[model samples]
Target: MPNLDLWTFALNCYAREGVETACLELQSQGADVCVLICAAWLEARGVARNQERMCVLEEVAAPWRHIVVEPLRELRQAWRSPAEQDEALRELRKTLKTLELQAERSLLERLQTASREWDESADANQWLSALAPKGSCRVALETLRNAAYQTQLELAGV
Candidate 1:
């Protein structure tokens, strides 16, 4: 588990039952899915949560998400209905989806690099709670947290 990367961990956690819905719910409420995934990764790795690290991660992610991911997502969402009728538009939308995913992956890599040197601590990891948006759905956040813990156990073969 020492070498577990954030992207793989995020994918696995997201693939778990209820996790996608949970993440989507959180996302719709203004939480950054990538940052939430990074939080889950850090929690699973036993990295203690603190305001300083949280700020650093947010600083690293906010601009990229606003400038790159958000525009692609907005464009794709705007095309959703039109793409249903136009084949070419559908194809273009598909490409946009792929690009959006790539952008998220790139963001995850940057988050990993930013937090790579942080040492794990015995202090309880509250990353998921700390990173989740205020007034967010508790059920969705718990779903994400449970999936992440289950993913960690699965990866550790426990």
Candidate 2:
């Protein structure tokens, strides 16, 4: 559970080039960005993915994701054009986007706390596939996994 703060993992990963775009693409396909961040952390820490852990994640994150995080994300995305047109709206939109990211970080914290009992074993694809499913968000999952791997490698200085 050491170094498993979901927020830290996510911020580090999301800061990587192309990760934000990839995450947004996955979100468009109904993939839970919180779950994706959890998956990346699990993968990075060598956590095993299974039904029990999945259920834990879902229970912890589903409500917040559906009710809070997703709405903030949608609102942030919805502001993209309006923010561009109005100079004043730009700063407000930026603050909102920051809030959206913080909301996601809270969701990730919940996930990390709930998943503390699970075993750790690495395999990036399982969590992505489990969260997304075949043919639904496959491309996004693949894209995320590749990006996660590169980010992990880079962070490790390998």
Best by lDDT: 1
Candidate 2 residue-wise lDDT, 1-158, digit = tens: 34546676677788877778888887777778888878877776667787877888888888998898878778878889998999888898889888887887788888888877667555523677777644565656767777666666665666
- Per model, how many backbone clashes are there? 0, 6
Regions of model 1 farther than 4 Å from truth = none
Model 1 over residues 6-46: C-alpha lDDT tens digits?
88898899999999999999999999999999998889878
Q: How close to the true structure is residue 131 of candidate 1, measured as C-alpha lDDT?
A: 90
Query: Lowest-lDDT window of 10 residues in candidate 1?
Result: 1-10
Deviation (Å) of 13 in candidate 2: 1.8
Estimate the overall C-alpha local distance difference test score of candidate 2. Answer: 0.75
Per-model TM-score, in order, reads 0.97, 0.81
Model 2: how large is the Cα RMSD against the reference? 2.8
Candidates' lDDT values, in order?
0.92, 0.75
Error of 2 at 24 (Å): 1.4
Q: CA lDDT of 55 in candidate 1? A: 97
